[model samples]
Target chain A: MANKADTIISTLITRSRKPLLDEWLARQATMAGSGAIAADGDVKEYCTRFLAELDTGLAAGEVGDIRGAGWSGMRELLEEVSRSRAGKGFTPSETASFVFSLKAPLFALVQREAGDNAARLADELQSATTLLDTLGLYTVEVFQKAREEVIARQQEEMLELSTPVVRLWEGIVAVPLIGTLDSNRTQVVMENLLQEIVSAGAQIAIIDITGVPTVDTLVAQHLLKTVSAARLMGADCIISGIRPQIAQTIVHLGVDLSVTSKASMSGALELALKRIGKAVVERKARPAAEVS
Target chain B: MDQIPILMVGDCLLVSIQVDMHDQLALALQDSLMTKIVETGARGVMLDISSLQFVDSFIGRLLNNIASMARVLDAATVVVGMQPAVAITLVELGLTLSGIRTALNVDKGLALIRRIIDGEEQAFDRREG
Candidate 1:
C-alpha cells in the first residue's frame, strides 16, 4: 500500500510551503544568531531549495526509505549544504541543525492537520521524525568527509613545502632537512634534489640536517638513498649539521659515516668552494668605494 | 643499422648517445670506440648522456663496460648529464658506476678529464724526479 504518512505530509507541505518555510527559517535565524549562514539572504535560499527538493522526494510516497532513487535529489542537496557549511567552519551540531530545526514547524503542521485522529497523528509524526533524523546524520557524515579532504590536501602541500631544493651558488644546491625522514619524505627529497642538480647543473649539493630531531637506522637508510641518487646524478653531496650527539649515535650504531660530513653549514660551504677551485677571503680595511 | 658517432675533441673522444641503444648498437659503439681510442691515442673519453632520457639495467651495464674498456686502453672515462630519473633507477638497480668518474656537464667533464690526465702526468714526473 502507498504510504499514508507520506501522502499526508506531502499534501500539507504543498498546501503550506510558504508558512512552513517561514516558521523553519525563523527558528534557524534565532539559532544562527551571528553565524556565517544567516548574515545574508543565504539561509532563506537554502531552505527554499531544500523544501523544493523535499516536495519532489515525498511525491513518490516512499518517505520511510530515503535511499530509494526517488530521494537522490534530496540527498544530493543535503550533501552540498553539509560540505559547504563544513568548509565554512560550521560546527557539526550547527550544520546538522539546518535539517533538524525543520522538525518543530513540520510537527506542528502535522499535529494541526491530524486533529481528531490520534492514530493518524502518531503515524505521521513518527515518519517525519525518522526522515529528519536520517537527513541530519547524513549531513554530519558529508561534513566530516569534507573536513578530511581539506586536511589531506593541506598535508600534501606541507610535504612539498618541507623539501625545497635551494641553489646556494652557481653550481651548488642545498636541502635543509627538518623533522623525521621517512621513506616517502626521502623519495620527495631525492627527486627534488636530483631535479635541481640537473636544472641548476649543480656539481655540489649540501644536505643540512640541523633541524632533524633524531636519526634512526631507517632514517639513515633514507639519507643514504638520497645521497646515492645525488651521486648518480654526478653531483657531490656533503652532509652537514651533524651535532655531537648524532655523530656519537652514528658511530655507536655502526652506520657508515664514510660519506663526507661537516659539523656546520659554513664548513661544508667552505669545503665545497675549495672543491670548485674558489675561496672566500676577507679584504684589507681600506676598501670603501668612492664617487668623486 | 643506426650507429652512434664518436667525435674527437682536443685530446678527448666525445661520444654523445643520441638514440635509444640496442645490443648491437652498443656493442658496435664499444668496438669502434676501442679502435678510435687506439687510433687517436686520446687520453680521455667523455660520455654526454644529457639528451638521452631513459635507462635500464642494460644501458647501465653498457656504461660500465664502456668505462672499464676505455680504462684498459689507458683513457679516463667521465659520464656527464645523467638525468635525475635515470640516476635513481640506476641506484635502485644497485649499479653505482663506481669505477667511472662523473661531472655535471660536458664543460665540467672536460675539466675533470684534464685534471685526471694532468694529475697522472704530474705523478709520473714526480716519480721520475
Candidate 2:
C-alpha cells in the first residue's frame, strides 16, 4: 500500500496542476530512493502525508502557486521531522545520510531557480553549513532561500570591508587599527589604507595597530602591501604600535619591515606633524602650503 | 574583597572586578554579566579587571562564552583595566578569552565603548551638545 502510495504521490506531484504539488512531488522523488526510503512503505506514507497536508493548504488558500510553495513546504515538513523528539534521536550518521540524500535535489532545485548564480549558491551552502556548525545545529538539507540569504550577507560584508574610511588631521591622516589582525581582516586593512592615503591628499598616513593583538606573517605581508601602496601614492606610511609578540613574529617570519616607517603611534604623529611642517599647537602660524 | 559589582552605562555593562578571582567566581559573574547585557540591549561591554591577579582556563572559557553571546546579541565587549602583568601572564599561559571584551582602564574603555556604540556621529554630537 505504501509503495503504491509513494508512486501515486510522486506521479501526482510531478503532474499536479498546482505548482506547489508538482514541486513537492519532485522533492519527494529525490528522497524516496531505494535505500534512503528504508522501506517502500515509509516512502509511500511520507508522500501521502505530504499530499494530504498540501491539499489542506490549497483548500484553505493558505498557499498560492503550488510549484514554489510545494518545494518550500516539503523543506518545512523535513524541518519539522528533524525538530521532533523522534528526529532528534537519529544517529549522527543517519542524520547526515538523510541530509546528504537531498543534496542533489536541492542543487537541482536551486540551479533551476537561481540560473546563473547556482555556483555562488553552492559556496553559500557550504558557508551556511559552517555557520550552522558554529551554532551546533546539524541539518541534511538547508532551504535554497536560506543559502541565498547567507551568500547575500557575505557579499554585503565584503563591500563594507572594502569601503575605506578617511580621517583627516591637519594635512595628515591617521587610520586607527582595531581588533585582532587575522589574514582576512589584514586584506581589508591593506585596501582601506592605500585608498585612503591617495584620496586624502596627505603627505603622511599613519596605520596605528595599537589595538591589534599579535601579528603573524599574513598580517606582516598585508602591512608590507600597504607600505608599498603608500610609497606609490607619493605618501609615507607609518606602522604604529608594534607589540613585542608581533615583533617576535616578524623576526620569526623573516619578513623585513625596512621600507615601512615603524613607530609607536605618537612617533608616527610626530613625524606626520613634522612633514606638514606644523606642530599641533602652531596650526595658526603656518601657511596652508607649509602645512600641506 | 567584596564580590564584583556589575554596572550598566549606556549600552555597555562595566563590571568592577577583584584581584585573584577564582574560576568559579569569574564564571558565575560572566553568566550574570552576559544575561544583563542581553537584557539591557547594550552595544558594548567593559570588564574592569584591575583587581584580578590570575585567570584560569575556566575563566578564559567563560570570557569566550560571554564574547560569543555578546556577538549574538549584537554587542561589542571589552575587558578593561587588566594589569599589564596579568595580561602578560594570560598570553604566556595561553589563557585567552574567546569572545569577551577587554579594556586597559575604565576611562579609556568607556571611550572605546562610546566609539563602538555611537559611531563618530554620536561621539561628535555628544562632544558638541
Work out candidate 2's RMSD over C-alphas: 23.6
Can you write out model 1's per-residue Cα lDDT over A1-292, one digit (the tens) per residue? 2365345678888889999999998888887533665853467888998998888878866777889887898889988888888877888888899999999999998888998898878878888888889889999999999999999999888889999989888888999999887777877888888898889988899999999888877777667767877786688999999977888888888888679899899999999999888999996667456422
- Alpha carbon lDDT at A249, candidate 1: 81
The interface RMSD value for candidate 2 stands at: 15.1
Relative to the unseen true structure, what is the C-alpha lDDT of residue A32 in candidate 2, on a scale of 0 to 100?
A: 32
Per-model CA lDDT versus the true structure? 0.86, 0.57
Tens-digit lDDT string for candidate 2 (B22-114)? 666777787787778768887877766667666656666666777777777877777665543444345446554434544435675676677
In model 1, what lDDT does residue A236 have? 90
Q: Model 2: which docking level applies? A: incorrect
Task: List the candidate 1 regions with Cα displacement exceeding 4 Å.
Answer: A1-6, A10-16, A32-34, A55-76, A112-127, A157-166, A178-191, A285-292, B1-46, B49-54, B73-75, B89-93, B120-129
lDDT of 1 at B43: 95
Error of 2 at A111 (Å): 35
lDDT of 2 by residue, A143-238 (tens): 333445567779769755644455758547777777776776666666666555545555577888878887877778767766644543345677
